[model samples]
Target: MSVPDTQVVVVGGGQAGLAAGYYLRRQGLDFVILDAQATPGGAWQHTWNSLHLFSPAAYSALPGRLMPPQVGEEYPDAEHVVSYLRDYEKRYDLPIERPVRVAGVHRDGELLRVQTDSGTWRAQAVISATGTWWRPFLPAVPGRAAFGGEQLHTVEYRNPGDFAGRRVIVVGGGNSGAQIAADLAYDTELTWATQRPPRFLADDIDGRALFDAATARRRALDAGRTDTGGVASLGDIVAVPPVREARDAGLLKASPMFVRLDRDGVVWADGTRAPADVVIWCTGFRPTLSHLAPLGLRGPRGHIPTADTRALAEPRLHLLGYGDWTGPASATLIGVGRPARDAAREIAGLLRA
Candidate 1:
């Protein structure tokens, strides 16, 4: 349980962290990857059992590691992805310290202090491969605590059987909400909450037309272009099952967000009453940055700011695994690795100096 001081410490162990670790290994830098989970894979392991990659298998591999699934194969399920992460770690012999939650990161002279649950670690450079999609977000409704109803986030949902033979109002109009509602439509009356009509990407318009362009932009961490808060403009990303299937059903209907939570059901912003026995908040997630105490977080009501342009701030601080496009790939498992590779070079130079 003793925390040793390392030259470079990578926080987070998903695609981004692993990619950075790969680069560090090539550069022969001394570092350790600290993951909060008891396992290697990040959020992918927590995804619904049936969730699959939207990207073609050819496009999903990290810098050096190859995803075992064949190119253009149907999106591999979460099980495959999780297994592959373990394989990736084993193949590289990555120095990953699991279940070591970074509690705080602050300046300590020339090195960075990384405090975890068991002990404290130090490093001259800290690569926060901690991605943007960290904490799940569900809106707080009035009387939610008092409401006597089945409440759960979409993450906790396995399938429609969770609400079998019951009325379910799904909150949020993005990918998860649409799919969950559609799946439950046969047995349950479903309603979807939305700020406005959900902008769904049609099959023909969503995806990377060329790998070269996608690779370049990905390496850049293209976060500045996305709007403050909203779903990815799912214009083109390959025909994921969510869009096609949801569209096939009439369940894609999105109503105004619920104004309040009643003991019996949800009351809409337009003063409409909808009866519901279960409420699934498909509201999405927020980036986890509690471990980052030193980097003053951005925004009062919007998403993470991509405006910090300092590439060499404090000669040690670094942000990794941020978005590349104003696209779903940024949020998807397939998108994080390239940015991590680019970030590693920048970090190495800072340490070498």
Candidate 2:
């Protein structure tokens, strides 16, 4: 079919996508953003009802808005983040086509052909902003079928209220695991297990985000040409001292081990059998790139091969909202502006070229 032409087509409506769209608008590019969700907030709306962002509100705003300090005094819940994103869309007059899933993307000579559930769009350039959260990694576990318990990944989790009377086994030990375990143990039997001890850091030390420490290590790795080296898992990111704090507060019981899963429940590395009514895996996410799989990815892992300086692998194709989306500055809304601006310049070049 002959597709409608556009200067640019942005995939994914998450923060990165929005930022790219806003920049695209500033550059006067004729573009439309395609998002799978009905609204603009992306997956943040699907987060647990009680979920509050760990980053302060000030750090959460997009390029055009400013979240207040008052909002940051405490964590902003899922709803607040959604409201802010909606406001961003309104301010920019962004042309985001909702619930439009990108079915396929390919190079049709010079133009990128984007076929969505809604229709097809041919763009001179395309921004694959489908943030990294599209896929959830659930490694194959032996005897998983045997453990007839309630199994769920963190994405499906709403809150701990439903877990009031159940023995919940929260595994993987990421922030979700820690927070969920802390809340659930308040009213039910809980065990927070990790394959290895995670690097636990203070949420804020004198107003500094703990994630900065991990970022520093990552920067060093990148500097040493080890961007794809054996990076630490969730447990490795959790430091020892704060982990003790979790144990001392009775928020979690240290079960530094992994066991087999079966109909009976989980069996720990130390040979302890814990009968769990629910198993919540707090394991992290996989970059959702299913639609882009046929695009001839140039990276070793599933990621598109992006040069150290560029966020796109080929002409008319770019990516934003990656793991190191913008570096230590990633922790602040301030960091988003520069990258968005850079993306805007690149999109402008495409429009002009």
Candidate 3:
């Protein structure tokens, strides 16, 4: 019946949670960040070895601290990003509790009760910034379970060396699929498959251009003007040096998705069979909202309706870093800061009132 009380309970310690904590501290609110990861880097610690930010270090930083530059690296790798996050936490002295996995959250009269592996916390508001890395999604293909080949999601992929000399199939049209395919192509016979052809940005274009285009579109819409189409989307693949090189070498081609998986390989829609020794799925991820199921806010598709970052069904609940549904580009490192700040301001106002 009793629980520790706080002004706000931020249920993640990744970029989104850190950004929220930064703004909450500036507002002088008593808040605690509960992170599932034992380490300080959050999900960045688990990314693939070759994964690099499409944006420069400065552009990829969270609020309050600039990601320090790496020597001779245009885009910081996963390790560098993790190190920066650890340094950011130390610099701000953000109050974070690690290795605390939230199990569920529900209404406790006028307050929200957070149930976690460690203990319970009753807070005036809750910010769910858990992000999507924990829930890598793969589409269901007929006979998939019967396949004898090695199947792995992007989460489990570490390096190309493990797949050397094997016939590999990289699935998905997003950045992860392209990058992983490029990485594997050098050491293995690789084939890329997607629902459709992957769109590639211009050689010179990168995350900065995508962010700018998104910003301009949003501005036009806010002013009741028709958005000028043709702006690069956040999901569009950035033509990184490696990806471009792969394209130039004719290694970045995508095949239409197969109809089903067989014992030894996949059967394409045209009934062509391609032998694959390993299948790596880079499809995408869903929001990690299992903790919020008790609230009955999720829709049939497992999405919670949100007015910006605030949950429509529960105003005291704010969701961040899930994806565009929560806010514009809320899932990205830089894109998350804006929504985090907004959520903090709203939470502060509610507590003050």
Better of 2 and 3 by TM-score: 3
What is the TM-score of each predicted model, taking all chains together? Answer: 0.84, 0.86, 0.96
RMSD of each: 4.0, 3.7, 1.7
Report lDDT (Cα) of residue 46, candidate 2.
82
Error of 2 at 265 (Å): 1.0
Clash number for candidate 2: 12
lDDT of 2 at 200: 59
Candidate that beats the other on TM-score, 1 or 3, i.e. the better one: 3
Position 280, candidate 1: lDDT = 87
lDDT of 3 by residue, 188-226 (tens): 988899888888888888777766676567667668998
User: Alpha-carbon error at 339 in model 3, in Å?
Assistant: 1.0
- List the candidates ranked by TM-score, beginning with the highest: 3, 2, 1
Global lDDT of each model? 0.69, 0.70, 0.88
Q: Give the lowest summed-lDDT range of ten residues in model 1.
A: 228-237
lDDT of 1 by residue, 1-353 (tens): 54778989888998778877998888778999999889878878887765666555665777677788844456677778888888888899999988888888888887788888868898988877777556678777896876677988877888667677888888876667766766777778778777667766666442343333454444444455534222243322234676467666655677888789878887876778888788888887766667775655545443334423113334465566654422224434565555565556767776787
User: Across residues 1-353, which tens digit of lDDT does each residue of candidate 2 receive?
Assistant: 45569888888887778888888888888888999998768778887765666566765677878765444346567788788888888888888888988888888888888988888898888777676556777757776788888999888888778888898888886766776666677778888888766555443331124344445555677688544322243223332333345557867765875658978788866777888899888888866777776577657566676643144557567766665543334323445455667767966975676
lDDT-wise, the better of 2 and 3 is: 3
